[model samples]
Target: MGTGNNRTITKTRRKIRDVDQIKADLLCARHLEQFKDSKRPEDLPGLGQNYCIECAKWFDTETTLKAHKRGKPHKRRVKQLREEPEPDPRRIPGAQTTSQSIGQCYDTQSAHVAHMEVDT
Candidate 1:
């Protein structure tokens, strides 16, 4: 059998945070690899620059978007998103209207689930 010291010295080791680094590297790599692969520059919509990570959409000015992306609140929100999953869709449907469903208890008055009225 091989000696313990020699075996330990010969063993291969990998970086503890290598996976995270690899993912980040891959994300960064995409911009270079994908950009070159697609030669048609004009085909890209809003091709001049990038959008802010915070805004997740286009920005009129690159400098303005960069400033917003660097803000503390934006970073904090990004961190929060990484930690928590998105909320359930059923929890919030959409704009709520005044309506009463069956089995719902009413204390003062009863009204429909939604009501649209125009002012006179």
Candidate 2:
């Protein structure tokens, strides 16, 4: 029994494509590490020199970056990105190596459920 305008506004919201790309980067250990401390120039705002990998945002200056780091959102992200303590290797039943996983595919699927793997 309210104005339909509000409902339309909420339903029309669209997601940014970069969010998906950010997720992909966050999942890769090497990418996250490189982004965290790398001084490389990027296409992002401020060339990504002053950027927050967790929030996927850039700041204009180190002062602002420091301020953002103390903020609740950044603190939350820091906690979120903290790596989980690895289970002691000797505790596992049949674990092979102690080196941490790097998001590789689990295993090759059987032919019945997989497509032909051809070099093209």
Candidate 3:
């Protein structure tokens, strides 16, 4: 019913990646590596069980730890930890609060789940 010239002009939008976002992602990855290394023990514990300080999770055995390493929740946590800034020790309330544990930052549901797991 209308002339061709009357049709609305639709512009094709260009997909542009944000440089800041890229930089932030790189920074997050670096921070995550640092955080992970900060808690890693030079020698494996005598106990068979292995602990993940970042997620406040304990693997009762090496097999369990291997499985946990490949799990989605653990992967998600690694990404989340990468993005989060380190907590300030001064903000923590304790006589000798040199560092804040990741357990203290976990959600109630996560805490409950961690607690529900029986150490075998």
Worst 10 residues of 2 by lDDT: 111-120
Which candidate gets the maximum lDDT versus the true structure? 2
The CA-based lDDT of model 2 is what? Answer: 0.59
Query: What is the C-alpha lDDT profile of model 1 across 1-120, one tens digit per residue?
Result: 855675555554321223333233334555334433544545433563554432333445677677878888668756754553455576555545443333333332445333443221
Cα-based lDDT for every prediction: 0.46, 0.59, 0.49
Select the stronger candidate by lDDT from 1 and 2. Answer: 2
**On lDDT, who's better, 2 or 3?**
2
In model 3, the number of clashes is 0
Residue 92 lDDT (model 1): 53
Error of 2 at 56 (Å): 1.8
Clashing pairs in 2: none
User: Mind sharing the TM-score for model 1?
Assistant: 0.29
